[model samples]
Target: MSYPLRRRLWAAALILGFFVLWEVLCLALQVSDLILPRPSQILATLFSRMDVLWPHILQTLWTTMIGFALGVIVGVVIGALIGTSRIAYDTAYPLLIGFSSIPKVAVVPVLVLWFGAGPLPAVLTALAMCFFPIVVNIATGLASTEPELEDVLKSLGASKMDLLLNVGLPRTMPFFFASLKIAATFAFVGTVLAETVASNKGIGNVMMSASSNFDVPLVFAGLFILAFLGVALYVVFSLIETRFVGWANRKSDFAST
Candidate 1:
């Protein structure tokens, strides 16, 4: 098998082994189902309570998708502008760093007050968490463009727009997609955190309610669902990345071969 295929197989085996070990330990220790439910129990709870969980999952997914899309759009525009312009980079980069450094969760209350405790706040929270990585990655990609290649473009009498479109933007595609994966994860996390803090309904609300009633197994079920959703989002983004950035994958394959 090729190296990539072998690596993938190894990873799958490792994950399966880890889960098997976890189940064995849980059985051996006879751990209370409440404190540390086995993976089987969590899976059982998930299936048993699917009807209750699906709507909450949908709500969270909607909010996260909206937020993530908005964040990526805005981050790409802002990052491109800042990265390509020295003046803009110097002026806005520090401010971007400062804002990104601020604890996003700390602003949840203010977002609730401003946007009210609903999907709006949740979307805003997700946007906030999802934007920074995209901006940083895109900016880095733009800035790291090969000076020699840029000079070649210039020598060909390329207009600023042409340079940006054909060179800068293309070079940044991989980094943009990389950031998208991270942003997708953050989008889900941010939505859940916002829902937990204050929301009418969501997976976070369901999880919180379960915790309040001491339904530990249900809480684990909720968490399992969240993990599944996060992985799903990441996989969706990866597929999109692979589709849109096919040249990157092709180049990688050529190099490996």
Candidate 2:
């Protein structure tokens, strides 16, 4: 009845409609389960494999959370340091850019070598995938503080630390939260990639094994589970952003509505 509820229904309907259309097309075209399994097949595979899937899902969730946690802490600290000082920013930004430029998949082998092919490598890979965006966003948000505001605060005898604590951190909150959504998705990618390359457990391994066995429907089900987690995490962060930093976005929400 209400607008928000109506919007949710519309979104759910659209997703359902897409799945229905996909199912119909797959059925009508006689698509093989090996090539592009119907949604129905994927769902059946998921339900059938729950006994095997649960442990893999748990392993994935545990590794991803650990990595994401580490990434957030390190990224926030480095970002704060860089964002608050031009010297720090100049020194670190290029290095961060260079490091982030490297494809994370390439680093899985090196991580596996060091960590010996278990959750550690997956955690580290997830950490590597996630931290960069957070660092960049936080640094940009902090550095973007208005010069006029900085001058005013300075004229009033506010020290750099004081200004940063009072203004810069709060201003960067939105950027930090925004980056979390992106980081969450990246965390899963890193974890899965690592697991596929080296790990014995997790959804990545399940998917990889399924592929080798030509269980395409099972592979798709594994992918769906990962995607579901990513979407769930993104939603959680979005809700958090709206909850804690909603004040910062009050005007924007009003305008959009």
Q: Best candidate, lDDT-wise?
A: 2
- 154 Cα displacement, candidate 1 (Å): 2.5
Cand. 2 TM to true fold = 0.93
Per-residue alpha-carbon lDDT of candidate 1 for residues 48-149, written as tens digits (9 for 90 to 100) = 989988899999999999999999988998888888888999999899999989888898999998988999999999999999999988888889988999
TM-score of 1: 0.92
lDDT of every model, 2 decimals: 0.90, 0.92
Candidates' TM-scores? 0.92, 0.93
Please give the distance, in angstroms, between residue 99's alpha carbon in candidate 1 and its true position after superposition.
0.8
What lDDT tens digits, residue by residue, belong to model 2 across residues 119-165?
99999999999999999999999989999998999999999889988
Model 1 residue 75 CA deviation (Å) reads 0.5
For residue 111, give model 2's deviation from the true position in Å.
0.9
Where does candidate 2 have its weakest 10-residue lDDT segment? 248-257
